[model samples]
Target: MRKLPAGRAGVAPAPLPEESASRPLHSVSGTPSPLPPAPRELTVRALVMGGLIGSVLAVTNVYMGLKTGLWESGCVLSSLLAFGGLSVLARRGAPPSPLETNLAQTTAVSVGAMPASAGLLGAVPALTLLGTQPPGWAVALWGVGLGTLGVLFAFSLRRRLLEEEALPFPTGAAAAELISTLHSTGSAYAARARGLWTSGLVSGVLTWLRDASQLVPPVSLLPAAMRVGGMGPETLSLGMAWNPMLLGIGVLVGLQAGLSILLGSLVAWLGLAPWLVREGVATGATPDALRESLAAWLLWPGVGLMVGAAATSIASQVRALPAVLADLRGLARYGEGWEATASRWVARAVLPVILLTGAMGWFAFHLSPLYFLLALVLAVPLCAVCARATGQTDIAPISPVGQFAQGAFGMLAPPLPSLNASAGAVVSGAASHASGSLWSLQAGRLLGTSASRQLLVQLSGLLLGAAVALPTYHLLVSVHGLDSQALPVPTGRQFKAVAELLTARGLEGLPRSSTLATGVAFALGVVLSAAARGRLARLLPSAAAMGLGFLLPASYAVTLCLGTLLAALVGRLRPSTTQTVQSAGAGAIVGESLVGVFVSALSLMRQG
Candidate 1:
């Protein structure tokens, strides 16, 4: 047994068992087998349960991603859910093994991530904002193709990232730890299950009260409209939202991120917003009109900040590129069996993905053949880079990488804004999907499960996720259009802003002030990201979180800050219950998000 290195508070407080050195690592092209060569590994029951849980998580993520540009992996949560469900359904024979649970959770996590990979959240909505909404079938094909490509990319790199270098993919490690603990004792499993259910139920009820029944409304922290410097009343979009999901996100992200979000909210809402109103840069009659107008203008700098930070971070990794290339060349010359083996696997995977993605691109977005070839070439290295980033930082740089793709296509591809968004979606979706799959593989590596089996399960999960997620996305869009306040789609707005700026008629397209703000925010993001590990790191804000604050309402930032403060208090006051606190937070996120989706469907039915 061994303890994981101290991670961020609330991530993995429990110790994890180390795998035996005697056990051989599975090859990239190997078939499925139990670690002990006795108990079951890939069972039909596990796949079914995982698909069911993953289907639910897919819907939950779609709603959450559209509302806030954030979503969970659902690995740990699904593991817990599968453990409890399988325990009840098991026959008189042996209960589900840890390896079985790991496989199930892998499936759920894969399915859960399909919404983002399918571009339902960011790229697709950005195109929708530009008056282009593709059919649901196209969306499904796009998601499945890119998602499968990501899995293959991760499969090719697993040995390098997971076994050879041994980077700490924290989420995967946490899931492994939880699985080990759950199977080892009944008491531990019961405690976690109870906490999850209790929190989820409470959060669901609150969501019902707030959104469905309208008994609870967000309270404005300040006056809705406040006159400043003797100018006309400036509408302040500041409030305490009745949002448990934001609170849960705050708890998960911790203090540093929360502080950064708060800083950006104050700067954007209190300072820049009022300044814009006073200068007549943003003019609207009522508070609603004013809020919308301000958001329209502020998204540019926000996108710039996010894009700049991502670029700087990716640039910093240039030093590792040569070493990675050298290793690949060495493997090829030595005739290591795995290289040729992975080549065959990748070749088999790429053809179908290319065919489906090509069809979707041509039918839905009118993308050129160059786009497909470029995205395919870009996806390989980008996936590896994203996987490495996730391993090192436990935060996949999906949006930044996507933004990078957008910039590349902007210069090279045709000047159509929808084409740019679609290209970004293809690349970013593949990166995000690959990184998440790698996390599951990391957990499988620890649990002595077959990587090949896990890969197959992940592929199945992707198909299941695409089938379920696309319909859910369409339903939500049909009921409450993409532009509704209920689904602000911050990242989507960012993509729209970038596409416009890139395709626009030079600087003459947007307001000069907005363009200038983009430049300044981009520079700030670059600086902040570059300085993150410097001596003054403790004093620096999170560039990404701060950028996100500019895109969301002040209420979201405030609520996230409050959640962060609450988490801190819990950690300080009752340290023993930290894990329970984490579970509660995760449960609330899933619960509220699920309820929100349900409410949207209910609204649609009522209208019908």
Candidate 2:
């Protein structure tokens, strides 16, 4: 066994048996498993894997947003399921090769962004309504715009964030733990697969029932407070409602992260939302407005916190970058067979294809060429930052860079009127998401998978998913009247609030107490983060954030916080088995999301 440097708490990087040296990183057990050799070429199998996993990711995200008013966390859950399942599968008789594992892990992580990507389809309807036919170039440009810009922006910071810092890629760490444990027993793959399918089915069914109005109770039980005197009327809130799926998310997120989200929600729902409703600044405190409100409040502070935290955290991980890059370069030089060259050629081919597709999208969407160009420029740096933040420097410069480029363009110069700069903000949020995926890919690499092959498969999956998702979104909208104005697409309560600010007659108003309160909350987060230690320190920001979320609506934040607290309790109680518990909780999240999507799709089919 290679004696590596001691890690945190003197724990060495997980040991791999010498016999497994020839196997890919994912199959490091070195056992004589009968897994198939990694595919040298892009094939039907790879594409199907990406597509199926991407779909699950999409469902998970949709359900997460619906259940807990958070979208980014879904990516974390999807990564866990995909990698965890593959790890377990690789241990069984039909174990996956290292390349296969890499492909699966990469594709799954990339696919996690599908829902957000597909959301771009809304541009079409909005443009059509404006009586303008967006050309293919416009649509393609939009893609190139966000993809390039987001990458650039992320990349500029990669050295500082990913290379220099060792921010805990919490989700990634969780995924790696699961993969390692599963590989140990060889049965982890089967268990993960079971979890994936089960979650998908459960989520799908719930979504369908809710859509069809068969499960109205879930939506109706809004937390409300009655006013006894004439000071005010009764108020309805969505602070801490319960659903099986959101609870699962809470469990996976544990207390720290979950609490932060809940705190954010509370500040918006309980504090700001009520004021907005009473002052007629917004419509009543309905469930629809809850997410928007929270988003609006979180925009600057949340982004600031995320960026600061990520930058600071990733600074610690930068030391690993040189070795990672050297490894890649070494592979390029020594692995000079046709297969290696083939992978290189594939990457080359994919770049132009992505560029061409992006160009076409820009024209089709009638996007501004300037915005597209800027996005392209920005994508490089943004990806670097994301890589640094997530501790997955290798994958950061690729998928996320591209996606961010597209998102940045779409947001900055979206074809639709309703889709504004905030769209760019939302796309910028992709850095956090891409960071999570980077961790998954890193796990694959650690297990000895080829980086080049993983890149190819993941890119292929993203393209396929984009193709299907665009049309699927259109069909759903046309048949079901699923307009953003109604369903809100990517813009939730936060976007609505921003829109209100734009449309409001006079936005040059004085500051309110809520603003002060928000500032105080942010300061509290920083202080708590500094003062706390170990798990408490790690969790302080999230806890403070959750407290703020709870103040939004006692009911919603309360339930969510409680759920998170329960999970944290579990972690504390069973530190050795935290990953297993987290996996189960993540499984539940996957189940709820998958079933919800299934139900939505079924309902749509039945309607058709």
Candidate 3:
């Protein structure tokens, strides 16, 4: 067996040979190692770890949804912190095998859905609006059902997406780096875990205070009209706000992306929104109404154009698919052999356990079994298509497949109540998330971990997430009255309102400033792609997405962008420390979000 450089743990020192490298490290040696053991009290430990981390994730998810109208990033960021911290702490006694590292990375990232999977909370407003709430068993069953559905959907797509089409699992990459660094440096996981806990707690407290009252002060200093001035007859606007975490996101995204997002916001708020307001097409002061009106007139066309560009660009890369698939096939065959030979059975056991858990969830919950089955079936094809569409031929499109499966389920079940739809949405979120976890696992596979062990750890985290998060959702909803018709959670309300407006207004011959902005931004992105060339250009889509995020509200965008810039500046100043800086920033985001969620949960607990 080829050995990596001494003391350089967690890093993939070099890509392994075609056959031997692809097999699990333990399996290749023909020595059956016992299952890779976790702490003695593994189940209890996992639950405790999950509960703490899950609580934090829940809060951050809600805060982000309420604050920026996005939930994915916050969840992703929090999961990174949890897993990264764990990996860092685990390095003390014996270096975690690649399998263990992969497991931890996968588990942490998988558990990230805590916030977005607000099962019952999501159903509450819609149920109330419809004047119905399911029985407790029904709700629990729903949670189990949707969670199972998500697993099935994610699993079906896993092979094709994770193995064949190499997607840029960005968050996974970050997690891998953290794990590698900690092990290499011989650091204790306990210290890192403590850091995560402390940071998370602080973040949670601050976020809670901000949401609880007016004491934090609104970040927007500009009046509505001033922000909306210029950019045609539409209402264009901007504002300045303070949010450390969002700012960090902006910085990490970089100036170009941040600026692009700002431009998107300018088009929507400054140009289109004001026009609608003045024309009496929308009511001022109602951001949700404005967003819907703008989305109707501008957002869809912009989305179409962007999709067109991505499709065109990606189609050019389709020739690489065959090669990528061959690579994955080779890995799968090798992995099978490793499982047969390796004694480290724990990791190998993960695949079956995950599958079993998913099946159990399906039966326990009353979701349509067909949807769950279909999700699995469609995953590979969808991932392949998305990979082809996005020109990411080297990286498997596992994440996209997961996302599409969930999205498809949601679409199919749309007429159902919000809670049910939310369940579907959770499926999508979790599946999309699994893509990243799979990516981490693949990374470990390259570095000599057994596939079975990696799979086990990842599943451990996923189950942990489900176990802790569902209750947290109920607690938050009950305490905060999120399910109340009078005070629906911000994101759900916004989504509902937008859907309503689209239904009422229809999409025809409407003025679309956001669409125009998107058009211009996309053109600019293409130029950026040309200028950046190679690896840099790969970030174009993310940059464009960031721009779109920014174009929402100036105050929000500005703060986020600034935070991102600060992080970037640190990266530039200490080029060698980019990963650490990123980890710290991500930790802060998770911390703040967790604090907010815990507070909300606590409030609910107290009220109950």
Q: Name the top lDDT candidate.
A: 1
In terms of TM-score, which candidate is strongest?
1
Candidate 1 vs candidate 2, lDDT winner: 1
Q: CA lDDT of each candidate? A: 0.80, 0.44, 0.45
Model 1 lDDT tens row, 25-108? 575679644454444678988999999999988988888888888888887888889888778768765689888888899999
Model 2: per-residue lDDT, tens digit, 167-261?
Answer: 44444444444444444555655555564456446644554565555664443343245431111212334333434565566765556666676
Worst 10 residues of 3 by lDDT: 391-400
